[model samples]
Target chain A: MQVEFWFEFASTYSYPAAMRIQSLAAARGVTVAWRSFLLGPIFQQQGWNDSPFNVFPVKGRYMWRDMERICEGLDLSLRRPTRFPRNGLLAARVVCSHADEPWIPDFVRGVYSANFAEDAEISDPAVISRCLETVGQDAAAILAAAQMPASKQKLKAQTAEAMERGIFGAPSFLVGSELFWGNDRLEQALDWAARAAR
Target chain B: MQVEFWFEFASTYSYPAAMRIQSLAAARGVTVAWRSFLLGPIFQQQGWNDSPFNVFPVKGRYMWRDMERICEGLDLSLRRPTRFPRNGLLAARVVCSHADEPWIPDFVRGVYSANFAEDAEISDPAVISRCLETVGQDAAAILAAAQMPASKQKLKAQTAEAMERGIFGAPSFLVGSELFWGNDRLEQALDWAARAAR
Candidate 1:
């Protein structure tokens, strides 16, 4: 069967989960449906003007260090960003535009690495265009597509669906109606999907 | 080579960590210094009157499920308590009283199992008295000690130290000045302590 991989481009935990989910799911003979959406709107509903990490400084500090150890164990490279919870509006919009593209996985990883590993500004159109080019996709066409009203609506709808499904955080995996949150829970979500399929 | 394991008795993840940490640390020949403290003061500092799980409903739902899966994976039984984030004051004070006892580990595990696995009320003195008795400790003496001003100060000091160490949550492990938060990071914390010893 399939698991819906819900992720936000700006989420720190989503970085590692995005990098390895494909291979891990493949190992379990399970298909992953990548669902990229905005965490901004969800956080807004929770009375947060910015990321909760910024709202809670202590938790924020713990999260960064946790990311360091987590990335090290996963063999993934991570660099501390100058900006806290960099805006992913442009990148997320572009991702939603090409949700069905075959090159999407590579595109997704590119955006994540660019933001987390390279410490680049993902909100910039130029940076997002580079992410598009890296995946062998036409930068101009996809970037152009992402700006369309229909694409904007798609992102909004998916984000709304995320809330409907009780997704409060990024890197959540949906197994049937069960929502498993966090990058750490990826394996369990896949296992749940595999067992259900059997 | 030792790691300070700082945990709040009310924490759900701490339940599993407390049960397995001793054996896990012994395998690596690492000594664990268990520090029981209350999260109430810390949470209040963050402008929260309750656990973050309760502050955020969606996260709360996800956490309960996550705990279920985590417990199952660890081969431990878990029951959803009628009350969540139950008052851990009594439990914490009692744990602090037996900080140097050889039976503290088993006593701590029994208390956690009683709350999370058996869904018992840990806030009640009767329940805590039972936990002390299970470890073959003098319940009357230990409980009496927990009620003392000196014992209360000990719990307070450890909790204050946790905050000073930048510990925002649990079960956090500190190897010297470095802090590792979460039950998932338990092995990594022990590894850090072991590596530093070499």
Candidate 2:
């Protein structure tokens, strides 16, 4: 069975899910389809120009504290990004453009680490280039490819498709047509996939 | 160690939480302080006249589906309430006024069952009266007590306290000053309480 793992680079909870999803899915003999999409468009449709966490300050404060506890439990380092949500467009294009490549997973994890752990400006090409290099890809070539019209268009279509599939947030796991949202539902999603296969 | 479980009767997820929390906390040797409060005020403070799920239809659709899976897994019966977010005010008053009484837990669970399992209108006095009677309590006396000025004030104060404690949602757990939101975090909150006691 295959599980589609949808994520956005700037999302805090997606970081932990992106880092661990591969190992967890592999253990269950499930294929992981890493889908990098933009949450900006999705939120915009909901009449939100900023992250819901920012639009609602009370919820925002609780989210950060929750993230700290979640990260601590998972042994993942989390530094609240200096920017509430760095523009993840460039980073998302990189992943969406080379989604099928073997090194895509490493590059994906690298970008998440950069945004969440290292607090690097993810929208910066230089920062994205470093992530590409870390995954042993040609930084200059991939950077050029990511800027192509086709590459940009692919990411746009992916985000639109996310909405079509009933996705409202990042770090969602889709086991067939059944949607499981949030990092907390990761285990349940995987178990569902495993059980369905049987 | 003590864990304060703040819940709302109209909340769908709170059904499974209310049904299972007592046994789970007992296993951890933790005391549970049930705090029943209203979410209407909290949502209004965030400029929402309705449930966030209702204000955002996409979220509402997903929530009902999510609740179905959650209840199925826990072997808890769930039926969509005929009225979405049926008023829990009167029920809250009853629970709040008699919170220290031994029958509070059963009454709380009974009310949740009425709304979620039986699809009874929790706002109806007869419905709440039946719940109180099921717990072998004096339905007339408790219902009368729930209408007293003191009962009304107690619920109001409890809701205000929920806001002060940064509770933006229902089924929240407070272990000391640490807050854990959603029913999924029940184990984690209980674990935190157990560990903190050490």
Candidate 3:
């Protein structure tokens, strides 16, 4: 099945998913198309200017605990990032530049780890540069390319596309035309992908 | 710490929680006050008119698998009931009538087992009668009383109260005025309860 993993670099849950999607999809004999987009515009469209976690405390607390349990079960390391939802503009731009390469998965995972595992301030240029260096890419050139007007326009267009596709959150898996939201939907998304492959 | 366990007899996830809440809470030096309520009205108010598990196929499939994983991990038995959501009306009423009894936990467990473990149609009067009998209750009288006008009104009022309290789903736990929804939120709820007690 042809599956597209639409993710935002700043989302907490998306870190675990972005780290695993490549291996999980490969095991099912399915190919994944990585799509990097921003959720800020989507949240704005919903009449909210921030993540729901910031809006609701009790639910937010539960979400953190739930993520802890899930990450432990999956044997993934997790550290509460100092700055949640750090700006993904540079990260998104790098992914967009390599939209046609198989290296997109590695790039996504690198960004997620840098933000979530290292607790780096992803909005800062130094943090993003470090992420690029870890992924064996030229940080200086990548940063320059990421700042180009064309790259900024591309990121905006992708966000607009996501909104039009009825995607309201990150870690959304698109199988053919079906959109499955949330990390909890990961297994079901795989099932749909397998069935589609058949 | 004193905790209120708001449960619906027909809820799939509530079975394991109902069976374990008392023991788990007691082990933690906490007391649980069992509160029986119906989820039908809540579903109706949300424009679902049915459980989200039944309304959304993809979500429903994931829930069944997720429930199995959770129950297995918790060392609990789970079977897909013959009826999706048995009319929990009679069961809720019986529970309400015995709300003052300390044996209410056992009754809730029995009802959950009958519906989720035995694949019984909980909405059916016969199934409920058998469940009550197993719990040593006067099935005939209790069943009759469960359907009485007063019992029916109590059920309606309880559901209304849940809505007034901003409860959108089950199994919800309230510590002070804070509402924590879903079984996944159990740990956070307990933590909040502990802190509140302190």
Candidate 4:
């Protein structure tokens, strides 16, 4: 009944996917597990020091424009962040801490909107606290708990598991053992989930 | 008016794009100008000695599966080439010589099918000759002409032009100065061409 949605807060395409996944899944009568993981460790294992977009200049240029065009097509506002790929470690830990909370999706969406739409730096604790508060969570308590060793370890373990599943990208979906990478494959992944239910 | 269809012979995605472009373009009342170029020079400029797929194992593994899924969806047979990205230089020269030929579309399709679908070695003159013959061109004469210094220079210059336009991959489309990379962008590129016509 549920597909796992693996995303990273720093991933650009993951922004739109996060914004769209919930309602689209509901319409198809499928539930989704919103899992937040970091892509940094994965990229590092591949010997990339920074985003592939940054490593390849031409690809990077096309990516920014592509994101603009995609957002326009989706009727979503996208303001280029002043600093690209602001650290999402703290945000991820917060998300991991509430992985099962009913309000987690809203909190996740709030953080993504703040980063991609409002040109905000998500690495800041103030932004993370605001996202938590917006979803009616206790900002202080969640932020405090998110930094605990246990919460940090959970995030670490999830990221390692992502790499173990042969995941090399963000905004990926998993229906059992089938891995569908990219936001473009969301529908197919959901369709796979629906058919598997039958 | 025509939009530029820039493709690399060794590109897997380019296989379907080459196979489907003509019919699809004709349906949309659009004419396409098939331009043969090499990604070797482009990849080299980015410091990649081999295909990015080869340079990154995880990406490479995903690419093969992705190509299989895409080809299945398109109802096209895809056989993994014995050697990935079999040297396509000779093939591009043959294609460049026929850049304006009435039968060039069929010729391009023939080469892609030979490489991706028929388990043929495009780098071999005999195979290149066969692809030409399949399209009703004089195999010996075309292959000979394709090897001449003038013909070789045409492909070299075109590859240079593609780089000048910031093309880093295959199956790209150009509508004026706008670059649409990937087979996925084919429709959008044609739409831009149609809109620009008005």
Candidate 2 segments whose C-alpha is farther than 4 A from its true place: none
Q: Residues A66-176, candidate 4: write the lDDT tens digits.
A: 899889999998999988878999989988878888998999999899999999989999999898888888999988998899999999999999988879999999999
Candidate that would win on TM-score: 2
Once fitted onto the true fold, the runs of candidate 1 whose alpha carbons sit more than 4 angstroms away are: none
Candidate 2: tens digits of C-alpha lDDT, residues A170-192: 88999988999999999889989
> What does candidate 3's lDDT look like per residue over A15-73, in tens digits?
88888887888889888888889988777754457776765443466667667767887
Task: Find the candidate with the highest DockQ and give its number.
Answer: 2
The lDDT ranking, best first, is 2, 4, 1, 3
Worst 10 residues of 1 chain A by lDDT: A92-101
Model 3 segments beyond 4 Å from truth? Answer: A1-198
**In terms of DockQ, which candidate is stronger, 1 or 4?**
1
True contacts kept of 1: 0.88
TM-score of 1: 0.96
On the 0 to 100 scale, the lDDT of residue B154 in model 3 is 84
Instruction: Looking only at chain A, give the TM-score of model 2 against the true structure.
Output: 0.98
DockQ of each: 0.76, 0.84, 0.10, 0.69
Better of 2 and 3 by lDDT: 2
* lDDT, candidate 4, B144-186, per-residue tens: 7877899989998999999999898999999888989888788
lDDT, residue B72, model 2? 93
Query: What would the DockQ be for model 4?
Result: 0.69
Q: Please report, as a residue range, the 10-residue window in candidate 4 chain A with the lowest summed lDDT.
A: A176-185
